[model samples]
Target: MLKFIKGNLESIDGVAVYPIISLLIFFIFFAALFWWVFTAKKDHIKEVSNIPLELSENETNDKNDLPL
Candidate 1:
């Protein structure tokens, strides 16, 4: 199966460039993500991290307020 796929890919012109482009895109995406994470504000990070806890608390409060 691997040989069959590689054989077909070998026939395509400029196939080498595709791998290079894909690698560059992958690297750039992670690089940008790392940059954003490093530059993000502490307040914003804390708020975002607490989103799940806040949601659960709100749901609990809502349930308590409902007619039993």
Candidate 2:
């Protein structure tokens, strides 16, 4: 496995740089997403969080209750 990786690395130009660049891009994307989620307006986050509960409650109310 080590030999295969070394051979492939030698065959590709700037392959080592690609991984570092990709990692940096991924980190930046997640950092921005985290900042947005945490720093966004309170009302916006509240609205988003309520969506699931609202849908589930509506569905549950529509279903007929079972007898004990």
Candidate 3:
């Protein structure tokens, strides 16, 4: 595996630098996303989380129409 990687690295121009730069960009993107998710309004997360559990008008109507 090491020999294969070395052969490919030698054949490709700036391949090593590309991986480093790609990893840096990925790290920055995830860091920003994590910060935003953890620090942004808590209420927004609460509202979104509750959506699946809250019954909609159509769902309530369906329940009401069910025979006892």
User: TM-score for each prediction?
Assistant: 0.80, 0.68, 0.78
- Candidate 1 yields a Cα-based lDDT of 0.94
User: lDDT winner among the candidates?
Assistant: 1
Q: Over the stretch 1-68, how does candidate 1's per-residue lDDT look in tens digits? A: 99999999999999999999999999999999999999999999999999877757778899999996
Per-prediction CA RMSD (Å): 2.7, 2.7, 1.7
lDDT tens digits by residue: candidate 2, 31-52:
9999998889999989989987
Q: Judged by lDDT against the true structure, how good is candidate 2?
A: 0.85
Q: Model 3: how large is the Cα RMSD against the reference? A: 1.7
Q: Which regions of candidate 3 deviate over 4 angstroms?
A: none
Q: 1-68 in candidate 3: lDDT tens per residue?
A: 99998987899877779889999999999999999988989899899999999999999999999999
Q: Which ranking of candidates, highest TM-score first? A: 1, 3, 2
Better of 2 and 3 by TM-score: 3
